[model samples]
Target: MPIFVVERRFADQLEASAERLDGINRINADEGVRWLFSFLSADKRKTYCLYEAPSPEAIRRAAQRADLPADVVTEVSGRLMPDGSPVPIR
Candidate 1:
């Protein structure tokens, strides 16, 4: 599976309310895409979601099904630590 970074920008404040999060989780159940994690900007205007899927198109489909914004989907090749060291995969 390839990892993808999905970016989304909100017009105003980005709210990650429990209900909205639940909705996303629900939509992901059968989308063939796994939601690894997400980062919400401090200003609450943007969100970056990390996902594992067969292709970027899968990620877009998941977002569309979840009714969430999918501004950009980029394929990522690696993950690293805050210290700039590569994180070992088990």
Candidate 2:
């Protein structure tokens, strides 16, 4: 699987109820995309989400189905360690 960092921007404060979240997860699963987690900006108008999927296109499709923004989809190889070294994310 490939890991991706998705940047989404909203016109207003971002909000999603638990039921809406469950629906989004179901939609993601249908597209073979796993929602790892997300970080919210201080204003809560933006989110940086991590995901695992077969390809960037799969992620895009999932986003489209969920009617969510996938403003930037970047593939990441691994994590950066404090010892000035790179480590595999898995």
Candidate 3:
């Protein structure tokens, strides 16, 4: 599996898009998405998403359903240690 991170700028339709993502996650079990984490900037005008999916395309489809900007989505690779810290050796 691969990880995709979406760096998002606020949009008028953000709330609606988030709602759609919830539904997508509920039904797309075969995609092997391990988890999805979303964070809102302190100013509330920006956001980011971390996703674990079987491949880049899986994340892409999920992002499209959520109305994420195509240019902002990117793939990343790494892992976390048992103590919840990212492995920095990469």
Candidate 4:
């Protein structure tokens, strides 16, 4: 699977409830996509999500099914740690 960074912009502040997350996760699994985690902006109107999927198309499909916005999906080679060390993503 490949790792992807997804950017989502919501018209209003996002409400991340457990029920909503569970539903999203279920949809993601159906598309072979895993929601690793997400970073939300201070205002909560924007989110940067990390996902592991077979392809960007899989993520898009999951997002569409979940009624979430997948504004941009880009593959990341790895991550740079706070210590300035480069780490490989699984």
Candidate 5:
């Protein structure tokens, strides 16, 4: 699977209520899109979600099913760390 970054912008402040978040999780699982995590802006108007999917289209489909906005979907590949060094897995 390829990793994708999905960006969503809201007209007003956004808050992921428990019910909404749960629905998102359910949709992700049902659509076969792995929702690794997400980062919401401090102002709560924007959200950046990281997901692993077969393709960008898969992500879009999942967003549609979830009834969430998919402003931009970008494919990305990289390592996660403070530096560029790889950390040993236990």
Candidate 6:
């Protein structure tokens, strides 16, 4: 699985506006995607989610179901470990 960073802008819902995020979480679970963590911007108008998904399309579909604006999605690439160790090859 690969990691993706998604930034979302939610619709207005007054006090219940926060529920949009809950919906996103549920959709992610239903899609078999893992949400490593999420953060609300200091301004409280946007959100950032780090997810492990099988593909970009899966994440996109999940976002669509949540009804949140998927403003941006990027694939993250990195070594298996933080230490710059050589990768084992067959």
lDDT for each residue of candidate 5 in 1-90, tens digit (9 for 90 to 100): 788889999888886689998898888888889998889999999999889888888888888998789999998876568877865321
Model 6 residue runs over 4 Å out of place are 11-23, 79-90
TM per candidate comes to: 0.80, 0.96, 0.58, 0.92, 0.81, 0.68
lDDT of 1 at 44: 89
Which consecutive 10 residues in model 4 have the weakest lDDT in total? 81-90
Model 2 misplacement above 4 A = none
Model 1 agreement with the true structure over 1-90: per-residue lDDT tens digits = 788889999889876789988878777767888889989899988989888888877778888888778999998877798999986332
Clash-forming residue pairs, model 3:
none
Q: Candidate 5 — which pairs collide?
A: none
Better of 1 and 4 by lDDT: 4
lDDT of each: 0.83, 0.95, 0.65, 0.94, 0.85, 0.75
Tens digits of per-residue lDDT, candidate 6, 1-90, equal 788888877665223345765776889888878788878877667888888998878888887786666789988775355686755321
Q: Write the per-residue lDDT of candidate 2 for residues 1-90, one digit (tens) a residue.
A: 899999999999988999999999999999999999999999999999999999999999999999999999999999998897999976
Best model per TM-score: 2
The RMSD of every model to the true structure, in order and in angstroms, is 2.2, 0.8, 4.6, 1.2, 3.0, 4.8
Q: Report the candidate with higher TM-score, 2 versus 6.
A: 2
TM-score of 6: 0.68
**Predicted candidate 5: what Cα RMSD to the true structure?**
3.0
Question: What does candidate 3's lDDT look like per residue over 9-54, in tens digits?
Answer: 7654345466676676764454566456778787766778777777
Which is the winner by TM-score between candidate 3 and candidate 5? Answer: 5
Candidate closer to the true structure by TM-score (higher is better), 1 or 2: 2
